[model samples]
Target chain A: MEEQEKPTKVVDARGSFCPGPLMELIKAYKSAKTNDVISLYSTDTGTKKDAAAWINKSGNQLIGVFDREGYYEIVMKKTK
Target chain B: MVTNILILGDGAAGTIMANKLRFLTHREDAEITVIGNSKYHYFKPDGIHIPLGIKNYRDSVKNPKFLFNYGINYVRDSVTRIDVDNRNVSTQSGKNYTYDYLVIATGDRLVPEEIENFDREAHHFYTLEGSLELKEKLSGFNGGKIVIGPSSIPYQCPPAPYEFAFQLDRYLRRRGIRDKTELHYIFPLNRVFTMENVSNYVQKLFDEKDIIYHTLFNLESIDAQKKTVSSLEGEDQKYDFLILVPPHKGQQVITESGLAGDQGYIAVDRHHLNYGDYDNVFVVGDATDLPISKAGATAHFQSEYLSGRIASEISGFVAEELYDGSVACTTVTGDEKAFTLYFSYTRPPRALFQSKADYLLKWTSADTYFSGMLRGVM
Candidate 1:
């Protein structure tokens, strides 16, 4: 198995619907850097909770989540 | 190295068999090859949800590498010819492969143009491209009269047409356009579902959802230029959106190879799923002209039994009895609630009486089951 890395980036999940953003997030986290910042921009209303739950379960750090222009921007850090 | 097993089709049957074959065999010489055209293995049951805006195409599609994770060799190629007499198969890339045992699971093809002007206006979501196109069409329009219907019988996913209607009702309502949109379901079947109990449950759902149902309905043609669908009843209905489920037939390669019957489906025993004349060849999923609905659960259950029979044939041991043709399915009724059903030839399918949370957990956990099943095979 390869060593895991933290994600230091923000993903624009805006305009993408459910499972779309999450799928992209999963794919993104595959090559992330440890303790790096990963942000998700989603226009779907459900992402705020979905991303939060995902962040918690994956043992990642939630930096901040905010609403802007009818979209939610969630930031996380790879903290393993 | 008793035999070289070749399985065609990357969908449910072939994928499951390849993994199961690896699990059931102890010999290192046994080789299994899976050939198909698609690189993305879709949970086809989710295809219907695309047009309803319930799920996107990406969520339903998994890379073919997912199969590789099961330790199955994946060949992304199209089969052009099968010479059963020569015990060889040819691909479009001019590669010829031979097998001691063959499982044909290429499934079915949809002919949308069978209905006049169908390709011009009516959209089908059975294929990946069709589903993506339908998603675009549905996402843009918030209000319109929408109609969904089947082009012919014996199509894949019997409950999909009704589910499409029900989900669309929910989607439109969520968009605040339900008042502007009139939802109607038209099918050639006498009832919404083949199983009496399922039909009763769905009929009650339709009543509650305010969706119209037309039974024994046949579509004659669509004047795409005029945006109207004409039925056998001689009534021409106008629609802002027309979702079409096209007529399905077996793959042309199987038909050309003379392996398929008049309807292009291979003839197989209901219990064993083996080719009637050729014992070494087996058919499962949509490729077999089975009497049951072409749902994913049928393929899963059939795979479990077929794999055992194939193993016994290889080991010269007596395998268990064949499949009883059992199927289980869940119908999404919007609002995060769904109805699960189990059906068999002996009895009608009724609600499984399970809550949606339990169902979703199991449904999402299917990958775990598949992984474990494949590990046993690998």
Candidate 2:
């Protein structure tokens, strides 16, 4: 397995549903500085797609999506 | 002079709105009047059980007269025209009424004719008549290729097709035809559901139960003569029993009045449920094009916020409370196990956990729907 990249901020939103994790990601993205690496942990099945959609739409860099034991983690970097 | 609050259609939204409005406003100040043709206020969700012989037709229905709160007016006539500019509506009975506020909760109109051969080959449980028809046929069915799916986007309930499939699996097993029957499900989307997690969870269940599913199989038309239904993707599936969720449009009056938006749905302010450019006009339920699942819970939630705002405005308070789209329901996976789905406009759903508690809740929801939710007390 490749070495994991540490993020500037980690947001855990495992208990929330589809939009909840996505909503939290947006909130974190808006306040972060340029080049700030952010990671989001979510249990929602749609967050992987929804967060990626938001990232692509907002012109950010997607690092990777890691499937953990019970939840998944999405890491992205602020590009603009 | 009494302020007239006219609510069109007596579906879950309209009836509850009228009742909630009645509670907040004094009868001397404003009179609530509902217009619809149906004498019975149907709990439509329970209609799905009809084909399985789990629910009686009468069990899914209630007299509108008994459901309405005292002092509210009931007009047992269909609305033929809505002249919103003049604030007047004309009914089929040649009667007209002027309103200070209008609520359009007419729900959806199933247009099965959208697909060729649908009228001849398909059986569904979305409507009372369709459910009864399917029940008679389904109960007599022994073994064959049973295909079930929605014919179009934005059908009645989001999780209904999946639930129907699981319930049918159990039903067939109980009837000793499990080994002989083949169950197939088709969805228009890329997955079995819109949400990724829920879709994955349901896909797992489908796999375990040996229920075959096809994603992105958009319905084209059915060739009843060939006993086959074609998809937009050039795929064809032969079937002995075809059950497709009826394609829908906005209610008749809504379409006639030019109030319905794309695909026969009303476009409204997502937060306030207000009709375009008309503050006094509101919409709720399956009628609105809010990009949310059309369920009774959605309409009921909208009613709570809508009635409060209308009442506040009428009382000169002018509250600024906005509604966050929230809808909740229980989807049964089998005979007595279900999972709860709850979400809002911005929040996604977390509904993968199945429990008997949720199943019991789903079972008793029909009773509470009429007594508590529709009664506007819960």
Candidate 3:
């Protein structure tokens, strides 16, 4: 039988500001270990773009991006 | 019918007054001259967010040239002397200009080195560069012991230090380092805020976040080389990163000019917004030693009220009215909700109006409107 990896942490940042949501995501990613996954949800209009930018520059893996009811749910996996 | 209106400082209040003069008054006789050293008006409300590495310096600045469309004459020079008896203000450039109605808008000054580490290791985010420097340092931060504390009272935006800590906690957690950073908040106040309800709310948030709090302790000094802050209680705190909110005072020019109160703030009547000594001079914003938090919203409310008084006095339109001392702020709760509170009293040292919102739409909209108006792009 193959061992399964435990899922990492998730950050919900829905209804935050440009930097507010981004800052929450960053804090979550920092406490997470390499290969750990962190989820972020945001209702701010700027979060989707800012999170994508931060992930690209910082080498974090994009697990998924979803939009629900004009809100964003971005899942990123920590990659050191 | 030409009346000379002399405005000092060229900050938020002064700029607003100048704009109001241009917009509301269409009389050809009004000549407005604003005496300020800086060619740009700084949007200081954004200063708090600067150190968190969120707001840029450029975002705080707008061209002074935009005042031209508002019919304001801008004089870019430091005020050297304000002669109330002569009704004249002298500038650093050796020019003396007289005023029919003098509006003193010289804002608050940061009392540098009020605590040990203020200018040394701990950085303040009240100015554009100060905020930028703080931002640069904060962005590269991985995780460690972080301490945010206010040295004393009467500082601009009393809730800023509190706000910074809350936001930082959320910021660090998002980056997966929340557990790595041990955050502490130290305030000398007996309560989080003077207002009972607001203080309770703030205290609740601090408790919920597990941010350590040291209340009623005075900040003595900072030993930068030691990277420690010694409290007046003889306790030393070690912090990898320190954000210090220094005590604020009135500008030296106001004190030197003998126009300020014993506390170095311009003394004004709570009702008419007039100088207690000289009726011709009007003081507004942080320059006045009012028992209220020095924030942009207060200045806006003050300006809106003061403009009417100025019109009544100069245009002989209406009787003098009193300032309600109403003010409020939006407490941004970590990319989720921005809490709004309003407070003011009917008497002196009064907290008159308080309102709270869970969004920043009104704040941001106001910022955009003011910025556009200042740049003549509105």
Report the number of clashing residue pairs per model: 11, 3, 42
lDDT of each: 0.73, 0.84, 0.72
Best by DockQ: 2
Best by lDDT: 2
Q: Which DockQ-derived CAPRI band holds candidate 3?
A: incorrect
List DockQ, one per candidate, in order: 0.01, 0.03, 0.01
Q: Of 1 and 2, which scores higher on lDDT? A: 2
Q: Ranking by lDDT, best first?
A: 2, 1, 3
User: Which digits, one per residue and each the tens of the lDDT, describe model 2 over residues A10-80?
Assistant: 89987666445765676577678989999999987768887776576566889989899999999999988
Candidate 2 residue B43 Cα shift, in angstroms, is: 1.5
RMSD of each: 24.0, 9.6, 18.9
| Ranking, DockQ, top scorer first | 2, 3, 1
Which model is ahead, 1 or 3, in terms of lDDT? 1
* Candidate 2 lDDT over residue span B252-318, tens digit each: 7777788874456887888889988998999989998776788898888899999999989888899
Question: Chain A TM-score of model 2 versus the true structure?
Answer: 0.94
- Using all chains and alpha carbons, the TM-scores for the candidates as numbered come to 0.76, 0.82, 0.76
Write one digit per residue (lDDT tens) for candidate 3, span B1-378. 877889897777777777766665555767888888765667766765666665556656777656455467888899989999989899999999998889888888887755545777877777777878887888889988988878765678777787778778877888888898999888654455545456667788888888888754457788888888876435678989988887777888888988875447875777677886777789888898675668777877787777667766667687756787888666665554566667664322233222334445434634674555443233
Q: How far out, in Å, is residue B168 in model 2?
A: 0.3
State residue B103's C-alpha deviation in candidate 1, in Å. 0.4
